[model samples]
Target: MAEHGWLFWALTSAVFAALTAIFAKVGLQGIDSDFATFIRTLVIVAALALFLSYSGKWQNPATLSVKNWGFLVLSGLATGASWLAYFKALQLGDASKVAPVDKFSLVLVALMAVIFLKERPSAQEWLGIVFVASGVLLLALRR
Candidate 1:
């Protein structure tokens, strides 16, 4: 079960991601994208805080090393940028088209992992990336 944990979480992530696109698209209909992103972020922060507080896993901030803080801060910044862009895209484009294009990040992540993390993906993984790329194009192309 532990070995398949990531697969389970990835599947869960995909489901929630679909819901995110749908909800954000509808919520963004009349609001500024940046403000929408801000509201979403606040809700996420509150939810996580509540979860951590209930779980008793809210660690002391001073326990983190500088390296850990640096990476987490960078990750947070990237997430914020991605959310802002995604919300703006949803505001301007069809959710169906924008979401598939956004998911091209999946292919990019595989490549980036190879380059930056030196992780070797199997041939099957590469094939899956190819299919994902193809699907994105199919979904996003106007003609």
Candidate 2:
């Protein structure tokens, strides 16, 4: 919130989440889940490379430190692990149930930001969280 530019990222992320659910459903229809994830990584790496090139930010390495590299590697590992677990979860459980459980990461992140960055959600953010949580829960509810 300090940087209003993050608003765009937040909006984009919401779209990405919905798209991910729909596309993952279609992807699971025929593709091997692990193979699908591996292929997606290539797409992501290519997209990132393209973004860096287009932004003309590829030349700059000074801003990144060893810790940044460590974090990036860790993040990639986490992503791969989560993808496997998620796809398997979807195969076993209802997507609506699995999705809301997954969305708890949002709450975890908010708490982590408060602890690590001393950042607090504003009133609007809390309201957004309420709506997000409610939607997820409603989705999870059995008819």
CA-lDDT, candidates in order: 0.96, 0.80
- Residue 75, candidate 1: C-alpha displacement in angstroms: 0.5
Cα lDDT tens digits for candidate 1, 11-95? 9999999999999999998889999999999999999999999999899999999999999999999999999999999999999
The TM-score leader among the candidates is 1
- The window of 10 residues in a row where model 2 has the poorest summed lDDT is 87-96
lDDT of 2 by residue, 1-143 (tens): 57899999989997898777667767777767777777777898999999998998786667789999899899989888998887766666767687787887787788789898999899999888778777777877757
lDDT score at residue 139, model 2, on the 0-100 scale: 71
Give the best candidate by lDDT.
1
Separately for all candidates shown, the number of backbone clashes (residues 3 or more apart, or on different chains) is 0, 0
